[model samples]
Target: MERLINLNSKKSLTNEQRQAIYQRLLQESSNGKLRKGSISDIANSYAVCTKTISRIWGRGKLHVNEESMVDVSLKKSKSVGRKKKQINLGEVKGLPFHRRSNICSIANSIGVSKSTLHRRVQEGALRTHTNAVKPDLTEANKMARLEFCFSKINRSLSNNDSTFDDMFNVVHIDEKWFYLTKSSRRYYLVPGEDEPLRTCKSKKFITKFMFLAAVARPRFDASGNEIFSGKIGIFPFTTLEPAKRSSKNRVAGTLETKPILSVTKEVTRTWLIEKVLPAIRAKWPQGHTGPIFIQQDNAKPHININDSRFLEEASRDGFDIRLCFQPPNSPDLNVLDLGFFRAIQSLQEQESLGTIDELISAVQVSFERMGSRELNNVFLTLQMCMKEILKVRGGNNYQTPHIGKGKLERQGNLPLQIDIDENLINEVGSYLGL
Candidate 1:
């Protein structure tokens, strides 16, 4: 069926559409005039009268004769939209956070129109940010964070720009809890489809499992080939035991995988000595030789970096695998906490989990499913955060810097190491009395 275009009503052609028409007319023209019915054909295709097409062709030809760009844009001025209302950001900043917490409150405080402020927000001129309260840093914590970031820099000056290490040998380990289901979840459903109904013993008693994740900076060869994935493994804190008594869900003597409700220093040490150590030694890049560092946070349940048991297992098979602690109260310093854990958690949430076994499998699948490139990006972000840590003299008050790692990777130009300024190094070093 042939569709109809309303000719009486005004039709607005975008700049690209007008330019396309002009180029078509130029192609079909013999000298100045179009081929016999070229105008009619183009008009019918665009659903515009021949007159509109002729007018455009005339203006385009005039530009061709004058050797200028086609003036196909509407004659209307660019200032066609409503005049934007401007608010003094300085004044807004001066107001207390509570006063400018919402658009209505901000407008009332600054005496600006609420609708205008909302429009600005909608246009992204202004943003509504929800900032969680950051962990308070004591003077001691600041110094520790500064020293940790400083240790990351390679003082050898091997390159023109002194940069942080590639971190290929350092494995960042962290613990996270994955619940069977979120207290609240979002789902897309077909029209008239019934929403999913979920029941739980209690939201507080939701099935949860703790996991220890270990990841190193992924390795890439000279030609950008993947040498190592950097994914050592993610270990779940679980125990397989037989059900002592018969239950509605399971028969007696059936094997059940249960989560260890509480994580302790002893259990964590056991995992490091038994699971984490073996996985690292087996998966460590064959050609790469170095004192591999297992960087972990200073949690209460974590064993000391020099734990005798950990050292005993880590030193096997000519490998100098060692444990080290990142700065306390600083999650950004660890690559897993910086981004990898969050990435895997989001993927885990997408799976339908009903049992503890399902949760463990889901978390494991999410861990293995993540690409090495993403893990490398997290390590790069870790270096960028270190730079920010030094900038604030060890304060965690700045936003994480994004250097378009994905975009750079797609362009085959992702950086292996982020450079640090010498002045910044000296300034921070002197402050730390190093």
Candidate 2:
């Protein structure tokens, strides 16, 4: 019968085929006599290519027994495949910055394949970063940030043992807008399941409500049991208005709640007096009686410290709540803006809401549902960022600090405060001509 030939010329021979060819060649050599076309005969019989048989026959000539033939018939060595191509990262780095913006462009400029560059990236030879635009910092802004970090240090400690205060007396307050629905969402579905259908009037015109959130560092008793959670309250800026005409969803003259689209000084003052101050009074721990500072950003619409309405309610119930502004254009100084708002926003986005009221309720729920431990960690992160600001001499060019907060918490060794470098502080002081 005619034997079938391997269609792929580059296919390597298996161990069994290699051994069979070796045995046949050994038999032909042992008799000290051979047919006129023995090598080609064996190649046609085994359906292997002639080139592979010639190479195996050469190796079989070195073996004298079946054991030697078996050893010689093993698979190819590790280095048998194609050689790996190397890209000179140093050469790539010499290119203009704009030319190295993407993998395809960089690969072309550096004379390397994009797939090889991608593999190098997966192997961590190259790194990818997302750049964000930071607010410009004036000289005055830098000085203010420096002073703020200095103020948090416990100067009462000996010059050698200075550390940051626990920040228990400071309450961070900020305003954020919560939308009723996101333009797009991702959901996991079973095979053959229908995709979720969502419709909206316009992506940009989705209904959103503004909220004022207040939080403080949580307090714990001697046993580490939480006595007072940091969450003071979250109040929405909204109002109820009567519908003028009958609609498909509601009858005429029905009171419909709507978000206050434009939050002005008057609205902010009202919420502080009516909602914020009351919540703080009711939730403030009884044992601690020191004055509390409500820290906010310097926005034009925010109420000033001397606002008549806020001053009246702030001093009542034996509580001294004072309003203080963080450094101008410095959102990083506020704990809420630094990370808390983003965390709660992620949680809020998980829920589905239809009306302005439902959106408000969802945000409030997310705020309350956040754990005290997370709030405390964010406060710690804020303090760490302040240290970074000081290190950079007030410039916002430092990397975010990450000291394994989760691992620390698991080991029950999470610190309530971070220590500031005394030498760094003195250097900053001299830099500012203090």
Candidate 3:
């Protein structure tokens, strides 16, 4: 029937003329093909019946060749709907709470419109605060630190009557501890991994650590800095894995196991006496005249200043080993504690070592790979910290010179042992802005 209609409709027209008429009709209806434009308008313009145009261009049904029917839904939408124009605003400057002004100021400063700024504020966009200026370390503090280090260095040389130029004769001593696991409360397991799998329990795994280490200052390179320095003395600690027991849970067929681990002060004392002292003696054979210092914490084991065996060992060697006790509980004052831990944590995160041997190897490699320069940087940072401390509390004899608690006690509640005079407190308070 369509073929008969087409033939009758083209009876007065040549094939080329008929094709041209059909193409002209298609061109007029092409725009309406994708949008809300009227098919009636297309039919009137192309001299075709509305019914014919509707039949050919029904929804998604077209008489046109497949190649010519490109999707123009987007173009149609843009042509019919209204659009917004963008404007340029200048740079914004002030904070919200401080300025307490309308969004227009921010919009002008930020090169955006007030509407945009208000919309962001409504959406909880926060303004950044400008930080106040900070004061540098005072000159008095700097000079005091310079004098402290130089005085110690000089006193060391004078006591021995050695040439002030011989830096090797001065042995700097420090001790550090390393923890096996990170000291954080949180632990995560991968999805689908079974919990409480067959693994060594940290407590029952005989987590006895390798010995504490003591190193002497290394000979300086031509650059006047310490090189691959110091002898390491490991005083292995004696810790024991206690028994493990499983407990029945109230829930049917459920059980939990807890392992017991234990350590003793005797173990520590013996390690220091039998291992550490002997190691120091072997390292510095020269009597007190020899360059040796057992610089360490005032810990009962290391300092053991009154221990007959430890003192005898030092005195016999003619090495006037000094037990320089830092203010108690001030781990921040000891760079090795913080810096070494940071390095250890960084190295451990990249690799997981399962066995004790592997972990030990990892630790040793981490320590060895950390260049002397890095160690010196740690020390330099420590030096700066020490200077800062002295600048704040130089030459003052507080009844309690050491601060064991994490925070300082209030002036009124502070014990007389603190020995903080009213004048000094006022001065220091002003220095710290109370």
User: Residue 416 error for model 2, in Å?
Assistant: 1.0
Best by TM-score: 1
Q: Per-residue alpha-carbon lDDT of model 2 for 288-315, expressed as tens digits?
A: 7778999989998998877777877888
Candidate 3 lDDT over 216-255, as tens digits, reads 4334445455544444443334333433543452343333
Q: What are the runs in model 2 whose C-alpha is more than 4 Å off? A: 1-80, 94-102, 108-111, 187-193
TM-score versus the correct structure, for each prediction = 0.82, 0.80, 0.41
lDDT of 1 by residue, 311-343 (tens): 888888999988888888999898887789889
Return the candidate ranking by TM-score, descending: 1, 2, 3
Badly placed stretches (over 4 Å) of model 3 are 1-211, 223-228, 239-265, 278-291, 298-303, 316-322, 394-434
- Which residue ranges in model 1 land beyond 4 Å of their true spot? 1-9, 13-95, 99-116, 156-159
Q: Cα RMSD (Å) between model 3 and the true structure?
A: 19.1
Error in Å for residue 60 of model 1: 16
- Positional deviation of residue 378's Cα in model 1 after best superposition, in angstroms: 0.8
